[model samples]
Target chain A: MRRQITGFSNPTVKHLRSLREKKHRKAAGQFMAEGLRLLTDALACGHVPQVLVMGEQRDPHPLLAKLEAAVERTGGEVIETSEEILSKITGKDNPQGVAGVFAEFDTSLAGIDRSAANIWLVAQALRDPGNLGTMLRTGDAVGAGGLILIDDCADPFSVEAVRASMGAVFTQKVAQASWGEFLPWLRSGAGQLVAASLRDAVPYRGAPYAAPCFVLVGNESRGLPEDYEAACDLRVTMPMKGRADSLNAAVAAAVLAYEVLDKVDS
Target chain B: MRRQITGFSNPTVKHLRSLREKKHRKAAGQFMAEGLRLLTDALACGHVPQVLVMGEQRDPHPLLAKLEAAVERTGGEVIETSEEILSKITGKDNPQGVAGVFAEFDTSLAGIDRSAANIWLVAQALRDPGNLGTMLRTGDAVGAGGLILIDDCADPFSVEAVRASMGAVFTQKVAQASWGEFLPWLRSGAGQLVAASLRDAVPYRGAPYAAPCFVLVGNESRGLPEDYEAACDLRVTMPMKGRADSLNAAVAAAVLAYEVLDKVDS
Candidate 1:
């Protein structure tokens, strides 16, 4: 059934706005996915959208029919809303005219036993949502065991990250935990730890990555915490040839992920 | 001298908004750079901002004084305006409340002769500004000879790309040319042409990167154009391990860039 929602004061719109906050996303165990391609990918992955919000200004994009078909199969709810309501929900100038609220996948590394050959990515306190998304994308592409988010990082489900990831967010298993919560896993004798740092680090490719190891990337501004840096067995750094001191966080992660993958494949 | 510009109608503010259009940016030969770090990097790179504008509500950022000093040394102009005016000029949120209008650097690869050892990135019709920016940043880090922009790509100078690049847009020498214009350089007999495709191509690492080769990255949706793909001597593909049929554009480019760099460095 299709219904029109015009007022920003509507309860459905209010609930959508709350999804933007991390606390709400966690408490509800759901995150909002915007843009047509992402929603379609989620449906393809067998994740059902609980609610579908359509912007009133758009007569429904060409991809809407595919989404509608998926909704029918999943037995989901469809809510049509005005452009003003979507703009407020997104907090942006342009609304893509479609959004889906999907139950967040329970991504936990708890069951997987660490091994000497398993590769993992440890993202420490990255603040940019887009960078985190890109990191997850690269991590998934290289078949990393899992992505471990430690400390104060951006919300992985923020619209920007989801968009930047280009559907990788749904496929990757990302486990978010505090340093204390993750300490036991880090100490697990399953793999070596390779910390990425500018100081006291050898060239990334020069470091031995044949062993199962976790690549630890630090915050956007401050490098990784001293404890994490000191705890690692290997410190690897990318060689900088230009005047720019460092590459973007996502770029650095990709280079490292590819290096690890290439080493394993060879 | 510091002056208060109260209204959007003010001459300076009007001129800044005009820059939102591509025609004005081209005619003035200037582009906008945002955030404190990027503006500072531009100054350090010896490119002065023609106009520096910031939000009036917030206290000056620490780098603002340094920017003022740099502007004074370079004989440039700085202006303070309300947050609303800044919002009007950038057409994007100004959370940092700092932005600068920089004179675009006119770089051409015309006179430089290509050798078999040159590592080049050819971006063919990329649509996302952030992806383009990240690609440019990665290209610079991996020591690509230069970035060659093909037809129908996103504007490298757009605010999103500039911010995503983290000032690499200025640091990397990028030359824009159409397919016909780029044909001569590709046929110069200096390097192998490797196109990245998802077809029956060799694994990227196994593919012989004989330097002086140009790595071709296709559009976000269509991949590379048929003509460009046909012109390539070798096609290399990154082996995928997951459900994702392809990788992010920037991530793909970074992987290829690193592989090429490793080949040359070794």
Candidate 2:
């Protein structure tokens, strides 16, 4: 089905705009991603948007036509929206020409396959959407099975995070759980829980690493709880050679992910 | 001298607010940093603010008092302002209760000591302030001497970059030069220019990373100009095991920085 949304008061426009918020996204079980390139990536990854929104004046592209055909094949709705409406839907002065609305993925621990890859990234209390996105990108780069969000973390499906993920949002498996649930589940699996720490930590480089390693990082300001670090199978520390006390949470994860990949791949 | 700023129309308030924009900041050769901790770190690094603005309701802190004394000793001005004025100056709904305006540092290539550290970070055409900030933090973690901005990049002294840097903006030396100027200067020194590339590139792991390694990252989207990559003394490729074609620019730098650090330190 195809529709045209011309006014701000259109129900579909409101529905699409509401996906920008967490509560609305949760209630509807849907999230929005903008940009033709991003939507094409989603389509390539076997995710057909339930509703595709395109600016009326978007330039013609072969990939965009393929996307339209795929959406039609999947019995999806298509909306031609004005630039002003696109701006309103995205809350950006300069909106991407195309946006896609997809059903939010299964973000439960049960959805994850523990042994799918040699490395997995786990973050706790990560509040920054950009950091969550970066972790997804880092996870994709290292061939990690996915990213496991423990405790209170940013919404992985937020527009900011999705944009920052650079399409890794569709590529990476994202699951959310409380630390309590995560620890017990990890204990039941054949996985190594490792963290960058100072308490009884060996140097990160040349440190003992076991796969499939679950490389973990803590909050931006408070870091991981002492007992959490204590529970890790391995505690490795990266050197802080300057006045800055610690690395950014996502960078720490990237540095650790690469280390684990080097060891496991070798 | 200490004075009270009760209204938004005061020239001092206008001047403080003006520092937030790039043009005004450039004209004044000063930038602002907010919050007590950041200002405290700045003072610790021997960077006394030329202008200190505090909210009238701010809680008394010993460090803040020390900052006031230091600023006064250096013949600087201090302003006690209302929360409304503070909010207007900072453009944040909840003001940090304190903000400091410091003279911009020397950003010329001549100010850097190439022999001071084993690693240095260079970025070309990086547009995100947050990414620029992350590079600074990464450089600090690996004990890099500073960050050199090649070509047109985000303003390193921008408020967003400084905050994201976690005070590394003050810790790390910052220099700005065109690629034309940077190439000749680097050639005159004993430094290794390295980049993450796919052109006859070796795996990043165990690659030959020379001391004073300048780890360079290109734009967020456009990797690097072909000629630029050709000039790299070492071209290392990180394995991309998933659908993501590349890592986030800063994350790529972190992954490579650690690999280079690991090889050099060994």
Candidate 3:
């Protein structure tokens, strides 16, 4: 349906603004994403926004026309509102010309298809939305199946994360589960659980990596728990040649993901 | 000298707070850093803060006491102030109880030693402070000699960049120059300018990489100028299996830096 929202206090605008917070997003089962390019990428991935809100001042683009048609064809709501309301809905001083409301994807462990790709990215207790999103982008770059968030990770649906993903949010799968749930799920499937550890491990460069590898990193500061590292089917170590003892969680995941990608392929 | 500043309006507090701004920091040639650990790391690197401010109700630690003595020994100023004032100076809600003012280090292109390490990182028109700091941390991870900012990049001395660097800012060298200046400088020394590109490129895996290798990346949104790519000694492309076009700038640097490190060391 086509509509227009001229007021910032409109019920639709309020509902859209509510999605910016975690509890409201959980209640509505929807999350907000901005930027025309991001919504376009989401369309390319066969995911259409349930509600599309655009600033009336937005410059016309053919790609945006395609996105609007796809949303309208899917029985989605398309609302053109004043730029001020758009900024209010996005909670930004200078908002992107477009924003969309998408229902949260299936993030359950059982939903992940292990056979989809040769590499995967996983994080435990990741607290930063930017880092969480960067890992998703890294997974997309390395052809990883998805990112599995373990135990109290920053919400991947948060606006900060979705923006940082740079459209990877739509391309890569995302799964969330506790350690107990993820460990058993992996064991039941054809996968290799690998982690960067300082334990009895091999160098990350030439480590014997197998297909369907899961690259796991831990909390930003504490790193992987001792038992978690011990449980890995294979543990690899990246060289830390400076005063800082560890790499940033997302950067570490990307480096390890590329190594796994290079190794398993050869 | 030892002193107590209970008032937020104190001139020292005002000056320290100003360091949070780029213009003020440039005028003062000093930057503010918070967190006892970061200050300790700075101290360990023989960089005693010229002005050390502590929260009045701060916990007592041996390391902190050592830091205070070192500041005093170095003839630097040490002040105990209210947490509110500390927060005002650090521009953080929950201040880490300690903050310091350190003079900005030399970021001249001539100061870098080409023979310092096997790998180096370069960026052209990099905008984000977090990405700049992450690149510094990645450089530290791969034992890269330093990070060279080739054009208009984020200020390395900014609070966000320093905090994101996780203390790598002190360990790794930093240099800033225009593209015109950087090209001639690299040519004058033994360094390979490697960038992630698809133009006449080879697979990033096992590509011929040489030390004193400089892995260059461009702005976050715009990958790199075509002319810049044409100038690279080696252009490599990492596989993109998913829909997203590229990796995050810092993540790309980390991935490429590791490859260069692995290849050159052998």
What is candidate 1's CAPRI-style docking category based on DockQ?
A: acceptable
Interface RMSD of each: 1.7, 0.9, 0.9
lDDT of 2 by residue, B1-266 (tens): 77988978999999989988999999999999988888988898899999999999999999999999999999999999999999999888988999999999999999989999889999999999999999999998898999999999999988889878988888899999999999999999899999998788998888999998999999998988999999999999999998877889998898898888877765
Docking class of 2: high
Each candidate's DockQ score against the native complex?
Answer: 0.47, 0.81, 0.82
Ten contiguous residues minimizing lDDT sum, candidate 2 chain A: A257-266
Question: Order of all candidates by DockQ, from best down to worst?
Answer: 3, 2, 1
Clash pairs, model 3 backbone: none
User: How well does candidate 1 reproduce the true complex, by DockQ?
Assistant: 0.47
As for TM-score, the candidate ahead, 1 or 2, is: 2
**Interface RMSD of predicted model 2:** 0.9
TM per candidate comes to 0.82, 0.96, 0.96
Clashing pairs in 1: B116-B211, B118-B212
Off by over 4 Å in 1: A1-27, A34-46, A52-75, A78-99, A107-117, A210-212, B1-10, B17-23, B34-44, B52-74, B78-100, B107-117
Whole-structure CA lDDT of model 1: 0.78
Error of 2 at B240 (Å): 0.5
All models, RMSD in angstroms: 4.5, 1.7, 1.6
